[model samples]
Target chain A: MPATSSKPRLGVFKFASCDGCQLSLLDAEDELLAIAGQVEICFFPEASSRMLPGPYDVALVEGSITTAHDAERIQQVRRDAKFLMTIGACATAGGIQALRNWGNTAEFVRGVYARPEYIRTLEKSTAIADHVRVDFELRGCPVNHHQLVEVLAALVAGRRPRTPGHAVCLDCKRAGTVCITVARGQPCLGPVTQAGCGAICPAYDRGCFGCHGPARQCNCESLVGHLVQLGHDANDLLPLVRNFNGAAPEFRTVSDRLEQGWPEAGGPPPERIPT
Target chain B: MTDTRTVRVEILSRVEGEGALHIETRQGRLERVELQIYEPPRLFESLLRGRPLEETPDITARICGICPVAYQMTAVHALERALGVQITPEIRRLRRLLYCGEWIESHALHIHLLHAPDFLGYDSGLAMAADHPQEVNRGLRLKKHGNQLLEVLGGRAIHPINVAVGGFYRAPRREALQRLIPDFEWGLQAAIEATRWVATLRFPDYCRDYHFVALRHPDEYPFNEGRVASSRGEAIDIDDYERRFAEVHVPHSTALHSETRPDGGCYHVGPLARIALNRDRLLEPARRLADELRFETPCGNPYRSIVARGLELVQAYAEALDILRDYRDFQPHRIPYGHREGTGCAATEAPRGLIFHRYQITADGLIEFAKIVPPTSQNQKQIEDDLRDWLPGVLDRPDAELARRAEELVRNYDPCISCSTHFLKVHRHDH
Candidate 1:
């Protein structure tokens, strides 16, 4: 880590993803003015035309590595920053674009572009950690703005950020939301998905689609069995686990198992379940 | 005087996605002008194949986080059209309200954070905040109100989960919506002041005799449904989009350049097009503000889009307030529909411009094929054309100033390059 200084120099970088995670910083309307007063936003291209040279104090990187140029660019970013954090599903795990990893990338290219030969892309989309060491990883399709603010605040204050590692089920129970799965026989992912989104879907009476990645020690097999009992087959479970955070280790293992004809012996249990 | 020079901006800043501009001049004559979209393709169309049709709304929304609602709205509208499902009036109103939230959020962002810096002689909005804190604060608050609206109706602000194929999983309570009224009221005033403020900025004296295109509805300003119409007296059904408009691949850029099929010419889309096409349909405060700002119809200057976006922000707030005030309890949250094998197409007014989606599904509700045409791809050719036309006036200026001006030209469209490269619709040429 770089030596501590009076005001932390912040850097925001992007690779191959939607510009949403960085946008969350701007989306924090009230908090942004206060935050801007504290940190030197040295290199955020999406918000400013001016760029400051970096040996940045804290680097928040977004997007997955999907091209040869970006694959090399991320290493340089890592070398320049003292504390590097990966934000959103695209950076922590491959985003929805990672669905191409299982299939043929050439065919995938041909399906979208009229001139596939002109397009340059990697065969698979992988996260920033696959290429570099990450200090912390924040999860979400587009990360929660409040959590993003918390992380930045912690960095400025020289304290550990307080982010929960529990399942969406905990948030649902706390919010007193009727479990869509038990109450209406809907196939919900709340038991396996992470909780940063405040259990919004369950409160809205819909199944959690797992925008956040898998929670700590998520029991996806038991949840799959529950979904199957709710009349959904392996075909349904495959898409659910393989969505935004599909390429994440836990979620990918479950999805791959379902695709391989649902073996009686599934993958190993998660390392630790949230108490 | 004969001269040779190359002006290149390797990484154009303050835009949605990664892109660059390369211009080469020989003896004051423009030799090459290429707007290079280096954003890697995401292959959304290929991923849609074999997936259930119900998943389209959620899957496609990931195309661009800045405008996920646009992607979700277009997908559901097309899918509903295919399934022969007509949503209830209440559901329609709610969808419109959701769109208003997006417009406010997106427009406020562009006006204050992205585009405003160019006029203010600042490198970024953060830099400008030092001198104009009050204006910046107002813009942020306006944007916050928009986010609040999205959270109330759709769930979370970015990539909302409440929207599905037929309709929302659950409609918001009237009381919940009413809670947002005071903020919306403040937002309307802020947007109006924003329009007035931008009107004072010095716009370059440049206008192009171009084709302006957008979705035109018979009743209200088009948001979800309308006929694909252009200013050159050409109007066609949304189904004829593929035949009338086509995207061609250029060697230098990953994003395909779009054009009108018959003449192979470029057309302008987005805020300027929307306001020019449907000016009369704008509601009270926005209409009155536009009048005070002296916004004449057929605004051909691309730089004035800031004013147009600000006016739309005001209109969006007014429309949202109207919907919320008239909202009633006990409205059905969603209308159920069964899926069948068919083709459907729809075009909606995204904050940037018109976004169209077409899908063909199999008998069991599997997506056979999908095509998404975002606003940025449609504006790509127009941006290059603008550069070609506007370069002559500033050819003698310093390269840095010229390049900065070129970036501002591109920002006028507020291009979202991520949305453009997600679906390319590559055509196979049989040898």
Candidate 2:
């Protein structure tokens, strides 16, 4: 990756999620000009109208796979990409739209469109890695700008990008903020949530809603007990666990148990292993 | 003289979503024109079922990245109506400011990155930048300012987590807003110049008596709050959006075609519709610039939509400055919403056009049903009409030229096929 040996070719691919993750790249103000100079920017339709054929050096895939065509398309992207990275919660653990995975997708389709015959979609919205091997996955509802920049820079440097996989509680501790759960008895997903959003909810004098998906080794059972103690009922817990990263294994396990009318204090047989 | 070859223009190079222009003519007679949208439908409405009403803003914001704020605003507004809640005046004003940021950012992206290259005869903004580096830089600078505005108010530009159903998760500090005054001043100058520069482009001479529909406010240009109005003497409240304009499902697109109640044809929204309807409400500097440049109000040509977008950018900057001048501290109040059963509809003028959202909430605060008609779908029919009118005049031009112009016309609308969520191509046996 010499600076003078022509710029690295870049391609942006979208699947089933909202266009927010790709929009994050264009939203980069200071780094955009510098990055534009360093990369060929071969294909990014959201920003530029120009495109080029690719055996690309880096392919940043946004969204998840939600259709038959998209399921096939991810394989082609895998073949073309030298290094592929999935950005945002949708591409990582499935987006909030992944709520379809828990219910009847057929009925969901009929509920939305007047003519279901016209709509071509799969039964579930799945992450990109479910189909193809993703070189890296950035976790966030839409992803943090600093992490986005750092990942792109690391890709150029041919190294694993540094993104925090720790719980939001660590960031809250670092920021020296009081615990909303302990002090105000607010049910927060912060203990199980990723830390990229800068503990924004806690900073804003509210509880974290887990837009960044789940952290590694999240204790969903313990978190649920805390939420229950905080005066949250079944109705509150249902939406809480099923947020941006609702489909992630840990969150989904707890949510599914709750939805099936499991006891809050002690669930039956611990509900088929923790995520 | 049957020239049965299909003029397939796969113009997926610019903007959000995937769409292409398919035109078929046999023996010099136009047989079919289809604006095909190939973007996959995510079924936002279906997924919203069973989710809590509070998550509506955060979830719906995912509809379109370019105008996430618009989605947030419309979703929250609808939720408020269903929950029997009313946001404070200060919160409402702040919402307008946030929308202005979206207008500036989205419009700047279209005018500079997508549409400008077509006007300047370049393949892309990168190509255009080779000759007009300063212009490109200024557009970026202005776009940056808009993103900064969102950062201050909503905490981040795309999929902002700060805003919720009733009000913001946290109110922006005055010092944070005050810091943006310098950038606003600079963007104001840059946008004014950009508008003048865009005005210099050669526009296609075309006009139509469109049923121009928009949200009209009494005191200001429409943003988050306004009454729905049309050029054909139709005005109504937000709740009556479904009654006033009906969406008809066309086979050509997954996105529905919207028209006046009586017919399913074409109408206009976005810059031309707004400037046409609210010319008197343009801010002082924008109004002065319009007079200084002799830029006529209510421009009809679709090509001039680029110019109208540029003007809106200037107005957004001016409005942001005015808002910052009178900024107040965060109000201490919980977002008041109660469980109620109702059907709520809202239409906000997104940077592109009228973005309509309709929702039916159950008694227990669950979303029973949802419908969203983005600006791109609304303009799909009108785009086909423009092609019908402009194609005949420019058909004899080089295929490359015709293709380029055709793509430019589509980009002029800044259509987000992802938001529209459905379009298709037809290969007819007759053609």
Candidate 3:
């Protein structure tokens, strides 16, 4: 929706992320100056040092809630903004870091840090929606810059953004690229994955890794069946879907189903599957 | 009167990731200086285990958006080394071209948007844009050219998808590479002017005897391959990286501070280090521009790193142009390879500094173990040391002013707290 005020106050917040989605704002290179002209950039620490007191007109939040501080801090952000949108995989679905949600986070801490006791984090890495209400969720590993600009522009103009909710298969068809799954027998998530990435992986002769989250009304079961037909076992399908957007509800359901009943007899389960 | 004071910055601005600074003084003498990074840990190393080896390039790239190419390059090189896949000369050149795009994009962003505002006495680049519109536009244009180069080669500017273990999944056509030539040529000229422009900034009169460390290659300015070398006469292969350096956990910060072993002394890295060590290897216009700017080696003023970053930007553009000029078909983008169970190590010069990656792969191509040492972690100790030595000189300044200057000093290193902390949580302790 269009802003009530002439120059809408904008704030950008980070929780726990790679800083890619935030960088997309800067990556909007030419449009950045013009965007700054249109809105009041109140709180973007990655881009500016000048910070205005909040109760912002809009807030573009990145990253997932990983720490106790973040869990509490996000509530204050929601209180401060009139409209709050979660950007990228980390915020929309717990990011690739959300892979820890399936395993023991304490073990992950011990494995990576020399002194695990010094690090304080929640047992599960979770999406922003888990802690607070999110107005809209913009999906992508690092969101598409053009889509980011469009979302901001739409919000400023008092209209809904025109981002697509279709699958990567639609974008692949639109681009007239040969399907990697059909030709190379690659285990692709294009049929169920979202389209914002412009079908990039398929265009490059590789399978879609689902950097964009699951598309609206995705038929993941059908796609997994197709992969099985293409000579992939239940085991291969598990890791393929459990990647950047693995923690998303639809992807998680499929991955869990594929991983049911393992470690038969005494032999070790699969060599490469994460516990 | 016995006087004491404390300076604290809750969160630093204009740098990647979350970090803070706290300084304490007792009786007008500096007591402590801490560069605290509180970025939440994502546990990339632990999560990487059990993933397929080929998936590494894409997975590790998520560690930092600003330098995903660095992570991808390091991972691919390490995996290929273990797999015994010898990439073609053409592939090597292509990798260098892709890296050039990253360096150009990263350096331009840092020089203009992040660092320049500090030197110009503006609160932010947006404030500076009101006065220096032309300069800001030029910087953006240069940055856009770099992004364009990445788009053409890697399919996206941030978190590129084209890079694979042996080589790219697919190569760009000659026409695609040619399209960037015009913009790169313009960028090359603009980059030279940027170097000269940054040189004119009034830097504070401060110098330190830094033990600079960076990757050094015999034939070229280091990008993909080199020996780990430092100014204190220490040189070692990439495999010996764990032996010479170690990460120490501090109570104040989530990011582990890296120190040179034995005595646990700090060492400097990044643009300043790269330029100091590999100045002679700079190609054409960058070499001539460096000479004209009088950017002498053994230069220790951290604030002057903006100038070094600009000069490197020039090198990136020149290198990109050179690679495109020698473009060939080189059919079959990537070489075929089989999985092996062995450990492999590789170090590459990220825009910031040297980033090292080591991995042990299983016979089935799964990543059995993974270790990554990003440039920011390696520089964390040096940042604290710089603050300690530099704080004593400015102790008489007001608390707010001291905090501002301390933040600027940290920004000078262009530290990526996101890369360092892997996980960060800010805890404010005022004494």
Which residue pairs come into collision in candidate 1? Answer: A113-B426, A114-B426
- lDDT per residue as tens, model 3, B64-166: 9999999999999999999999999899999999999999999999999999999999877777889999888899999888888888899899999999999
User: Candidate 3 on A1-275: residue-level lDDT in tens?
Assistant: 24455798999999999999999999999899999989988899999887777899999999999999999999999999999999999999999999898888999998888889888999888999998889999999989999999999999899999999999998999999998887788888898998898898889888898899999998776677666655687776777888888899999987887777222321342343212
- Tell me, by DockQ, which candidate is best: 1
Going through the candidates in order, what is the number of backbone clashes in each?
2, 4, 11
Q: Enumerate the candidates' DockQ scores in order.
A: 0.78, 0.62, 0.73
In angstroms, give how far residue A40 of model 2 lies from its true place: 1.0
Question: For candidate 1, lDDT tens digit of each residue in B1-431?
Answer: 33645556667788888888867676576766778888888899998998889889889988888899999999999999998888888888899999999999999999999999999899888788889888888998999888999999999789988898878988899999999998888888888988899999999888888799999988898899888889997788899888989988887787888899888899999999999999998998899999988998889999999999999999999999999888887556777877688999999999989999999998888999999999999999999888888887887887778888888988999999888874111111111
Error of 1 at B230 (Å): 0.8
For all candidates in order, the CA lDDT equals 0.87, 0.80, 0.87
For candidate 2, report its TM-score: 0.94
- DockQ for model 3 equals 0.73
Per-model TM values vs. the true structure:
0.96, 0.94, 0.96
lDDT of 2 by residue, A56-174 (tens): 89999988888888899899999999989899988988787788888888888777666778777788888888899988888887888789989998877778788999999899999
Q: Put down candidate 1 lDDT per residue, A86-163, tens digits, no spaces.
A: 999999999999999999999999998888889899999999999999999999988999999999999999999999
- Candidate ranking under DockQ, highest first, comes to 1, 3, 2
